[model samples]
Target: MNDKSQLVFCIGHCRIDPTDNSITFQMQGCSPFANETTKVSLQPKFIEVLSYLALRHPNVVTRNELVEQVWEGNVYVGTKALTNAIWHLRQHLLPLAHSGPVIETVRKTGYRLLLEPEYEQLNVLEDNLKIIEAKLDTANRHMQFILLFMSALVVITGVIVGVHLYQDNLRMIDTQIKVITQDPGSERYPRLSHNRRWLVYGASQPSGNKSLFLKDLQGDDLPVRQLTSLNSSELRAVWSADDSKLYFASHYLDTDECAITQLDLATNEIHSLAPCSSEMGAIDISSDGNYLSYISKHESDKNGGIYRLSLNTQNAKAERLSCELTCNYEDRDLAYSPDGKLLAIARRFSNISEDIIIRNLNTGEEHRLTEGLEDIRGLTWAPDGQRIVYATENSGSRNGFIIDIKSAQFRSLDIDGMSYPNSVSDKGELVYHQYRRQFEMAYYSLGGNVPSSLFPLLYSGGGHRNPDYSTQAARLVFVSSDSGYSEIWISDIHGEKLEQLTYLKSRVAYPRWSPDGLKIAFIAPDDSHEGNRIYILDLVNKNIFALASGYHNHGRPTWNWQGTSILASTSDGITEFYLDNKSPKVINALKMGVGFAKSSTEIVFSRYDVKGLWLIDLNYPNRIEPFISDQIFNAGNNWVLTKGGVYFKSKNSTEQILNYWDASTQQVTPILKLPRSSISGFGSLAYEPNSKRLVMTLDGFPQRDIMLLKHKLLQ
Candidate 1:
């Protein structure tokens, strides 16, 4: 629209890169050469789009090219995805974008990185090329050093030193992983009430199952009790004044009014008040249960808006308030004032954005409550009914502000970041889960004086990860979320230093810390090649060499006890990613294939079920041997090489039982029961051999949680 410098439109700004995960840039201090100060933190997809544009900066990337990079060529990131991200970005950063678009459009052809760059130094084009050249030199030198060192260690050191180095390398690769998160436990926020009588939160446990749990709001971290048994999807829930009925939204095919459902806790009966298949999300009801308001995503309306249903006369009028079109205005904030006489609505109409609009039902006239403040948050009328306070995420920080209804005055207050409550009681005290904090480790404290605080400390909201202790010497590595993208990251165990690994938009999966610990292997779907491939990252060097690309349908790669190579399972797969080569090389031609890699050398990997062990060796060529296949599925995981045999999960029929396989006698023994199939984040079952502990990753759907399931490992 506004053709200032070049309009750099980031479509899916929140996508993680595949090549190296760390380089994501969504909303930040500023895009190079721009004065924009505002940025959107609400959506991750938008961030991915920004990352893509930043990577290809100073280049004129066409819309189609933008789509491929941002969406990983997926249909989900369609027109809406593109436009929404672009629009939101403009809302936040266009002011800066006015100087010059880090992006520009080409009449035709895909997109090219605009030559313009504002690095405080080199021009944009020079910066891109310089980065590529530096990495190239680093790769060449690293390969030469590794080959020379490995050649000697092959027999004398026997891959002992090389493998250990490689194992540490895997740890370093995690720093580059992208950040992909959602409701984490469930689609709703944790709801806490003052009486401390109940600590409520939504959890989608047992995988694909959503339910609510209530726990003692007190001292002891007591066990949680299940409340609602709706196996389907249960939306946000709010407590009624009497606490007699829990009103929420549950949508299923049976209910025509898929919109509203009043769960009467007294009778445990689910009542459907309004019948409309409109998809419903955020809901806020009047304390007395007299009036209700919620945002509905419907097929007919196409563009989602605010809707209301009343309990009086069964609230029969049950109307759709198309203020966006009918009243020549758009409504976002839809909350009822305490007395219910004034509806405190956050309204925005295209050019004119977010302003609180108060509609007097008795007067049938609407008045602008808070204008010129594009900064309104989840608004709730104060208990006394005079003041309306809401959480506002303005500029780059999140805070709470209050507005007076009668006097039309506004005041701002600083509160803890947990202010993301969609529905709050009239009570000044709020109820919501505190936002997770993320740390950005910075070196050489700004001043040699004070305790060097970690830079970019999670002041507002961010997901957290367990800091890997003792790994400082080893290397702190893990998959992480950066600016809404998922990528591998490698850092000092202290998390004082971090480096990102993946650069492509495709998501990286199952980063394995090699036994030798020099290299890490993971799966990345390369839509460009139209197939999944294994990517091996060299930690010390930051060189990414595709072990295998589209040609191999292989996945879940694990490093062998010897770090020089890796072991992977697949079907009709190809060998190491072939780039310069014109022809394809098949590593296997069978149904379930197994393969191994010895540096540049590789052979098929297979599981000998008859002998009951994994049997793939790089030196064996087509031959497969019996390793240690038990009754359980050890062949699948990065089978742990521990003092207490190999631990793995075996899915017999209904249950995925945890079991251990003895290396000596080759005996299989069951350990403990598990929650579901596969570990969280698809991470391998980490065997703490020193402690003989069997640890499994607990699943945190929407977003994975760092959970440790400890058990005794049979020696």
Candidate 2:
């Protein structure tokens, strides 16, 4: 064998028969793997983190560095956590003799890998069957010319398609586009007239280039006009009581911070209020325009939170509305009730679900009107001002609810599963947006039930949270806490049999099938921590459980290079430590930046977080690294890692573009930009190596989208 083929490695759990050099696992009962399994488990995330440190430095990687990756920088009490994870790894692997070299301590630094990696060139042709392919071309004058021709065709053709569809969309809106202006794009937050007959939105068009515009909501032929414009000025305006004045924050680049500017809507005259700039949070004025309240994020004292600014002195009298010891509470969402006696504000970043909180000015006491909402993004007082309406989400389903100010009873508003809700009427009429399959729209209602299509199609895959359009891209698999409160469930793309996979009394998320389609590993509710833990379930036996006491939050586990034992894990709360515990210690953790060239090692799903999405090599020892690291949130990679790289989605601005990251270079480059939305939610991935098709899901207006991207890596 040539010495150049020394990249393959196995420390403890890996075994290679001399005759063929095919990898083998030491685990006794584990079954074999197939070439098409790119969807790996969650356990490997923990182990993958550890392997990165081992491969990158070859020596001890500081525990602090390791903990940062695992704990996400919360090193508060991490010393003890690191000790436990390492202790478990040593206990499990010491006797395996498979861990190529021992993990040695460097006194003060970190741990190190002692042995050399052990080997042969992988044949890429073997995995070609698994890929759903497209034409291949190298980047050059030819490819660029083809791309240019396609771009021009799409622009001309896509516009034609867009205009035809947009006409239909306009009709469905039921409300006319009273004003369509080429907006300046940044100005005041919009507020409508009390009668809901006119519209107000930030207008950043030419002239002031930063102001407001009004639209006749009565479906008129009125042209859009800039209501408030100031030369080279930046402003954000809201509605003042009486609906005669618009209040906004402005930045006087030359003289002041973003200050509050009020415009007499009746006269079209602007008033540059002192000290009310963009620096201060949103402000709410009294019904009589006598008193005003806004958030001052620059907390001067523990008690100085929501403040009242007087027009006379411009002096803000501050009061602490919440305590932050137990939860992260920030001042926001301040609004004036019709009576002007009650102030409604939303507190965010609090560990507990935030909500619409009302304060009685006279009593200086506050009360919460909403609860159990993971996020109370925004709030507003109803026309009657007796209720506080806000948006919420639970287990990925977006909805809105209104709370009775006096009774504190939450009446869930029957809007489509939507977001960004705001009341648009004084007569109890509500207008919000719901996502359709391809675009978003402004929906309207009169104080009651939401409108439903005569067509009964579920936009969000029937509320199936992370819908995967199957490996064959024919069916779907998603984990829904909805089934008896959030468990792993599989269904067809159109919502067929809602089969349950676990009977455990806890939640199961992030499920993945083995290459051979015989087993799955999932993140489940830990009987110990009551949080997430990794569990392996054999589909054949169905009764057995493989729990990883070694790692906590053992994310979705993936099979290792040999498919012998899973690439199990342990983490330092921040960084993941890859351990091939087929028998004992980590058999052989792969180098930091490598992927399998073998057909069988394509990563099932490249998982991601703040840092980025990662690609894994399955056919070898666990080697994990970043795949795409842009702001591409909530996406996964399904690939057939045969030769050059695994194919997945790359973020091209807000779009999910088809791209291939080479296994050899560990570098990703864009291939085709997918205009279609993804099939799964953020981070959901389904790849059929044979078909070479990758399916992903992403958030879209009114509905989540499942996207199918077909590609091939001929290079």
Candidate 3:
């Protein structure tokens, strides 16, 4: 193996100090006294693969060699497993690769370590300690006596400070939280004025229109005044410098237009300032109140990007902040730094993955703050501007995390249902939005005597979604979080004989049954949380294995008609997986494949950089055209393809409607209107061709409100 002995003589074992427990992997050229170091714990398999590659440093090892050595020649398991392990190992090794990739991949050959491996050995630590002990007796007696005296004094001082710090940390960790608004409707994106007395938020009414409401936080029993009565939705509001006006995005339903509007709190007059996005994205005002920023996409652009407009200049157009390098993804959910010098934004690389990034407004410099996160709902800067608190969703659960801007250190706030973190007041009070939601499967029939009725398909709770029905076996499979964790579940059509399949406690979603009904395929994050990958379960043997698609992130998957291969969306695009092949084939590298048509000659899909649904005909694969190009479709996950055409969800001014497009006639018709108070809209749509039965997750007893966090740490 390319002179393994050469590495032994060149760098020795990876020398990590025994006391440094925070460090998992450390490489050469990284100084111990550096201002910051990347600390991450490595799994055993990651270390083994890394050590093997290091032994053959600067030499490409074939794929077969790795499978034989690491996985004991089980190519079926090792093929995609090796790719996943290597991808995660690279992420952990990123901080050390200042010059280049520490592990280099030779295309079509294999991977090799570019840097020499140095690891700590047990014997090395013992020998170093013995050497230090031997030199201790050579010191003078007087100097030794002075050292002992100082050591004892230092110990005493450390104990006193340690106790005080411990108590302070306890208070910060156990911060007191209270629900401020308990309206029956959903209230979202609360904004606290600079004076911390007035709070404004968007409240979803029974009519399905979101209106701005103002509340006096200082008065406990004061009635909240309705701020706006427009027929549009007001989202993501920010207070002016004097707290006399509010700036927010208004999405008009009739004209399908979105604009930045200024609301005079004193006179209750609303005026449109400039055009914005209708996606309920983000809006914020600079600390100095001279500029207003929001996410918008012009007619010429494909995706939303951060745009800034000058409030001081009359009729000033919104300028798009072009991201030439770092801000390359679709940007949303932004907050201005307290000093207005930097902006923290959530950068979405795809539907399933995004992370937090900071940008310098003047110099156009950017730095990534977080990585491998999913569904970043909202983020806000701390009052002092030294830290940021952002909320993200995994499966059905919501979580909050706080990160220090300079040090890049982050920790979970241990708060549940923290959807949109709006603001943190200077007086150590925080206000945000929390949605109390429970999703259950709803069933309906089209032609039967059901009379367009809605009934619960399943009895249990905890967010049931992504239902798939197998006509052959008369079985239905879906994802549910009832066990306090998202897991795969299966039952009959009537929701009887419910059996829990996998106990993977992590987030699981999008379970699809094979055509034969003998197997099921789903997507979940790997152990390292790299990204969601596809896995298959055999009902006959009760065994499970991952379907390696050679990509890190994967979305919803669909089984082909024959059930020999599966199609899914990954980081590369649409990929097809086979039962025997170790490598998957990428069909379309530009679009995300949602599902396959009945004849298997057409694939329904969407794009990351564009809107609207499109179809790819296998006969002429290069030609791509729109499928349902008219009107507004809610989300990609809220649609399904069937023999008739497509059954999708759309929203009007009052409520969500289920619409179906007829393939034969090429016409769109509204089928059913959903509940008006659905905060978290419908989940994945499922339809069985033979029975003409539809199953979807519906929000039940949806409640959302503004919450206040009283903590010393907020200050």
Candidate 4:
């Protein structure tokens, strides 16, 4: 083994600089494996283990040897610590691991480096210094003087820039945050009174229902009063001009209708105002208390719009406000200015891109404030109305941002898990909702006479979803946020040998494999349009390319049997995309085209206005027919197509059942009952033909609480 003092090892395509204890690798033509490169820092012990393995390259480094070398022979601690060291080292070498496993584990012995390594023993910097000394002794003094001057200048410039960045970061993170509610249930939609005497928020009850709770902020340890006891959810409670009554949005679980209600503080009575949309908690009151503004969808409209109802007039009807954007845009999360002259709205163009826009109430003019933003959770205006604070999301990371209405300049609060900005008080205090959640993956057997068997596949600190299997490659691709951001990951069909794939630092989903298994196509957000864009990853080059450039918002993408073209869902219908830059062909009849038959030209799809699965043939694209219409399916993407039939999950009033539609008989048959609780909204499905198993993701109950921030910055 070589000495560990000064050696730079190149393991496959990744370069390890032990001098700095950093590993550098290329991800999308950029590096993110070191402290100077990315915020993801590598553990020093993990690097030591890797360095030991490389020194003994191609030879099995026994567990005892690594433990003695890296952990100083602490048998009890080194046993498990060595295992974790190997795992983290592999994660850092993910780019090279995808091609082939960098470290191969010996079954009963130890681990060996599979990738060949090359290292140099000499230090280049020391060699350069000796050469400079020799040149100075030979009277070549001009070159020495020029090099020393340049070195000093570089040091001075680096110091100045470093100090500036340090100061800027300090200013950006100078906010004090405190979690106000720490109960066991989900709490959200916090509203602080204008006088700063009371704070109101929604909390989950023992019956698994949401209710409003009010706390007196003026006194310590005061009894928190229960404001609402409705069986349904009471959310978005706002205060009136005099704080005498609370106006809130309520959704009935039995009827599934959302409406606004006013609660009288004196008599403890509730009055109905107007009907709302399923998107609850998007209601706000005007400053003068003359009108109530909310977001709701008209029956004939595709997306919801901001609507205003006159609260002072009898028999007042809601009218949709004029939006200066396209028809496909969705307007939500609104806040009224303190003087009622402006309305701040979060407009979503697609799943990936959203922005905050200020709408003039008097002139009916709208202007954009923020652009290319991720999921805007909530928006609120400051008490002075000169600045606005909003919450947005990227992957699983949540951020709180404050923007000046006059200058349009903003900065992040740098507080993590700050999900929703509910309200700001006159005392310059901010109240918001903090949330955290995760999902896990599991598999269920579909084979003979065995009882229902659910096997845990993957569970970690973060979430995993959108699982897809490739029979030809014997690998599974899915999206996981275990690395602190949502990225594509791959593992064996048995959920072993996991490797991270993409580092886009954005939200991605719905990965589908090509027929040849050498490429993968997935859907990621594009800020330029109201729909998500399709990206194709070529395993050969390890590069990602967009499917097409257009305004069409692509849905879940599926590959053709030949793998030359991809069929994706659009607003109107399905469109076929080619790899050779051919013009896209649109088919208006089919909404989401998913799987292809093994030996036939038929493709399974669903329609927007229909209740069941439909199919179309490649030879006859116009001839579309219903494949299974016996019962309404839960969601379009909740089922997977295979050669035998279509395995789908259907929910009744009591339980959710997994059913299969046979290709030979064209009949639906019940297989087994599924776990009703904790199932994700559109629990996506994947199947392995050889293994006869189904994969799905399940979510845990979200942990939410109301948080308060105190700072003079907002003031």
Candidate 5:
């Protein structure tokens, strides 16, 4: 075969003659030269490389020649790209060529096709091409006339179809609601099998460990079977297309690494597919059962992105799919469309904002479906692929919404509690997890009075967090989600005359009163920008301005005793912002939660990597030592400092208790035994000196269960 003869057909296939038989290589669609019988697919770049090599059969192609032909003389294309393409091409070709290797590699040179492919006659191919071209031209003329008539018919049909769809949309979708699992332990990440006979989910035990369980949905008793016995945490169980195997990701407790595994449902056999770091996100299988898509950072990549792997190939490496050079984002919650043409993903740009992006698998083009949504926990595509249902936090509460992709219009689904959409069946049945959490702000008086709820009469449905008192103004400041978003609110010490301070409509946290009670400082996410910034609200003029700081990940802003400077915590370390200076000064090289003692000579903070409290003296910032050791302290909002010592909370085997650490005696003693509850670091703990009162947010027992929603659309 010669290159001149191969030029007869530019975009078709060729039959290569082996020693025993001939093999066909087809290149007509987006995916070129994929083996038809073996069902092995290759990337477009790899196909181009194979075609370039096959055209010049029996001739060695240099690396430079392959790169120039495949990449079209693109100078920026690195050698790694060509090496990867050739490697994949070799893998795809190895199965078809069973006699020996089809692609022969020359050391320090390029690759070549060993088989001599016979070229079809140029005149015959040209004549066949002309006949096909003439038929296509005739078909185009007929299509023009048919399109004109169809255009008129479509105008009338569209109105009728539009009316019918509007009526369908207006029809009630809610039908029967049933609680599937009511175990006291938390159940989440529900997935239904393709056959609709089994339900699988992850449930948390009393020891805070998770395992996977399978429920027989069609059985009379609806019994649940424990599928996995590993001590590690298992999440997001998805079934195989034939319902004979279950795939899930497991996080090892000891090493904190994650791995995807496949479990044969019948024989209970398990196999590991791939291992990733702790930052791995969601996983999904392709509709054809040939590829598995997931998001993770491989051992070689600097950041995590979407990747695809071939299930049939042994030890197949994941191919990166997401392009991050233009906009850096972390992807999660991958859901493949019903037709497998698009992939929907949740992309996180910052701590507070995330967007849903739809990516074309063939073209690598992305279209963002939702923008500026806060904290998207999970999302899934509808069975028809026309709408997307996602769970997000609205006004500090979790809710689900359905959005039309083309119109960008959304409507809320009326399910209660913190709901997360897990899976939607083809019949429109939905499986989700609903969570209910309750927390009350209790006031503890050190002067022998019992604790009570701060505002019993004005208690709202949403959560109230981070309460602080101002003795000078006889008022208290707190963050509340009662206004549909977390906002700063103020009330009198007696729980009267409540008023809202800031209205940024974003998530606000850790509100603290100034020493002189003239201003309030808090942490609020900058919606227009990135990261959480500290802002001060003037009580007299009602003015809010961001503090002068170069860093963005700042929180827990507390004023000094003299009210001349503020202390805040950042990801890098703790910083001090003076009222007179325009820039913040780095106080200490420690990443921890920080607060000043009553005397202002030292600061008490908690180390995240360690288990105890530490103190840094202002007179000697470099001298930081453990203030209290051998105590398991919660990371945030679990401790406060007074003039004498620190009042902190700790959990024992029985319950959580409040303890007092005396500075002079260097001893610790339990002050109060709190109720059995889970303490979230994001909640607040405050202490008042004048009234000797302690206040903290306690999360009551969480009610988590799996719920099933049946609708008319599912039928």
Candidate 6:
């Protein structure tokens, strides 16, 4: 055949003759050919060379023709390179072309295939169609059988899944729950060691002093050991991976400073790690013991954020992470993943809302795991690393929830009531705190000298707090969780004609009555902003409106006497918000809880760090001074300004006293000794001047204990 004819008849698809068990190559590596006994693998250039010769088998090809077609007219590739490629191709094809020599080198020309090429073609479309139809019929039957088998497999899988679901339901219904600590005092922040043999927790005595204690889980008869006796409060203890050391945060009462310390179990010695700036005491140590994660405020900015401390370094220095020098949100309750590849943090956007966020340590990429979650108390990583188990307020109650990280799907566990998830074991055992709080509103008559329950018969077993009395309507507006979620509720002086108002299903705090009693102002979580905003409830119209929205949490809202403006406390300080103009002006830049006097021109607030009550006169510049000193209190909410004096709750030793600071004589006198309950520092107190009655919420019954639950249903 001539060169032009040979080029036109170049091999296309690789062919095989099953009768002789022989295969012929097309464009060598262009098509991959494999069989039970033989396989052929070749390079692209070799495939081209073989194709040029295979199409013109048994015929000699000129060297110029072979090089031009195979090498695409590239002169730089010498004939020796072609010779090497041909040698390699022959070796690869020898096993497959078993009957004869695959290629033979011509004396002066290029090459020739020894085997006679069998070129097959369809002369009749009808015969070709019949062959294709027979093969297709066989393939369809095989496909039908495969589909039937797949359907059967789907049925079997569905049945197995249904049975598993039924068993899981039964397991959930019959979960084994045991109370580990049944003490009358509060026991919280339970942490299990890596081996699950020891559990450490913070236990508060009835005297109100909290200390760390260790319990032996394997032997119930073993006595509990007190790990900390520093007189200061110690909380959130975490065990080292080897269980030889424990790290926790200690807060000194005198200086009100918090420090992170590590304890050596063998030596019974404690070492200080770092001093924290904020009171949000959150810390976690990694499994490898190389780093410690905690929340701290920067020295320069004083804004709280998550920090990582390197233990292996000489100085054991800490560096800010997941944020710049100043973070907008307070990142607390940090938890390191089991693999130590990610960090989970509760980002406190405002006082009312905190959301869980996960950060990739290596990539520095952050993903928000929850949105608009109010009051996240604790968080821990699940053992499987695919989900995060956290404690947050759901339906006005603290509950444990498992959220899938990838899908962001969350479901509340069956457990209820003020649950703080402490730790999760590899075996799916959960150690958490079940908190029970019972507080009631009582009215103390200044003249009658008697305190009685505001609602003697109306008991709902929910928190009643932040009461404000209306002078015009002779009614009281307060925050209550009686309707499953915290809402603004109003009732008469005797708690009759009770009406539920403002169903926001979010945490409502510091409800204050307007001067004319036509409106009530409060702070709640804003769904659109995901932060605490000032909201006003129009009593007449029964409408609620957001008056202010921002990143800062606005609390302790008190309206002016004219009802033209509202004063509230924020992280920055006391802010005066005008009603007509919708403008906020910072009156005092000091961080404190604020309460307006009867005239509204003067305000009384409590200093958090200094533990003093200060008065601020808005009408006069630089008119701020200490009204009462040497008082240990929670926040401004614990104090209220009455026409007679400023009524406040002060901690004396272990007991809290309701003291009246006389407005006329400026003398502080104890009015009543509060009942010993687990009232946290930030308890609610309010006084009505018109009735000469003091309406306050005292911790009537508070019980907290560690609980252990074993279940396989969560998976």
**Which candidate number would show the highest lDDT if scored against the true structure?**
4
Model 5 scores what on Cα lDDT?
0.70
Q: How many clashes show up per model? A: 84, 81, 5, 1, 3, 1
The digit string of per-residue lDDT tens for model 6 on 1-715 reads 1222212111223454433333455544323342223323444455556655755566787777777786655333424346646655565554445566667777876778765544443234346558879999999999999999999999999999999988877655345578888876788888988888889998888777888889998889888898877567886788887889998877777878777778999999888887776423677888798888887763555567777888778767678785654345777778898889999988887787788889999999998887777778788888888888888874446777888899787776777763667567665688888876655666667666455423332466776766777778688887788877777888887667988876565677778888787888888765433567787777664545567434367766777768888877666577778765466877777765666665657766666556677777889736788777654444445777666667777665556677777878878787777555423354566555666777766555667899997655454
Q: How high is each candidate's TM-score? A: 0.36, 0.46, 0.70, 0.70, 0.69, 0.73
Predicted structure 6: lDDT: 0.70
Residue 531 Cα positional deviation in candidate 3, in Å, after optimal superposition? 6.4
CA lDDT scores, all candidates in order: 0.48, 0.47, 0.73, 0.75, 0.70, 0.70
Candidate 6, superposed: residue stretches over 4 Å from native: 1-157, 163-173, 252-257, 277-280, 297-301, 322-326, 449-457, 548-551, 629-635, 677-681, 689-691
Q: List the residue pairs that clash in candidate 6.
A: 28-47
Runs in model 3 deviating more than 4 A are 1-155, 162-174, 219-223, 267-271, 322-328, 444-461, 472-474, 483-485, 494-506, 518-555, 564-594, 600-617, 621-674, 677-682, 687-693
Q: Per-residue lDDT for 505-538 in model 2, tens only?
A: 3345556555455556566533222234455655
Error of 3 at 526 (Å): 7.8
Give lDDT for model 3: 0.73
**Candidate 1 residue lDDT tens string, 1-715:** 1111222332223222222322234554324433433332334455566556665665656676666666655333233356545544444443345456434445565434342323332365466678889999999999998999888877777567788878765544221111111334533344444353665555565455556666564644566666666545563566666666666666663443464777765677887776444333556677677767776655454345666777777547566664443343445556676667777777643211356777776776887665334334466666577877676543223456666678765565445342444333432344433333233221112224444322331222332222221121355445555633346766653344667665543345556665456667666543222245666766565545555333334545545444544444433432333323234344444323333332334332434323244444445546654455443454443234444456555653234656666767878776555444433323444433232333333333223221111111100
Measured over all alpha carbons after superposition, the RMSD of each candidate to the real structure, in angstroms, is 23.3, 26.0, 11.7, 13.1, 22.3, 25.3
lDDT of 2 at 434: 34
Answer with 2 or 3, whichever has the higher TM-score: 3
Candidate 4 per-residue lDDT over residues 1-715, each given as its tens digit: 2234646767655667766777776333323343333323355677788888876778999999998988777554466557656765766676777678889999999999998776654366457558878977877667688888999999999999999988866655446788788887778889888777789888875446678899887775878888876667776788988888998877878888877788888899888788876525487889999888888764455467888888899878877784533565778779899898899998877656678889998898998886556688888888888999888876656778888988777777776777768667654578888877667778888776868766778857777888988998789999888877678999987889998977765678888889888999988765332457788888876756666546446777878878888887765567788887677788654677354544446677755556777777877888887777736454456788887788877765445677787889977888777644445654478898887888877655578888888665566
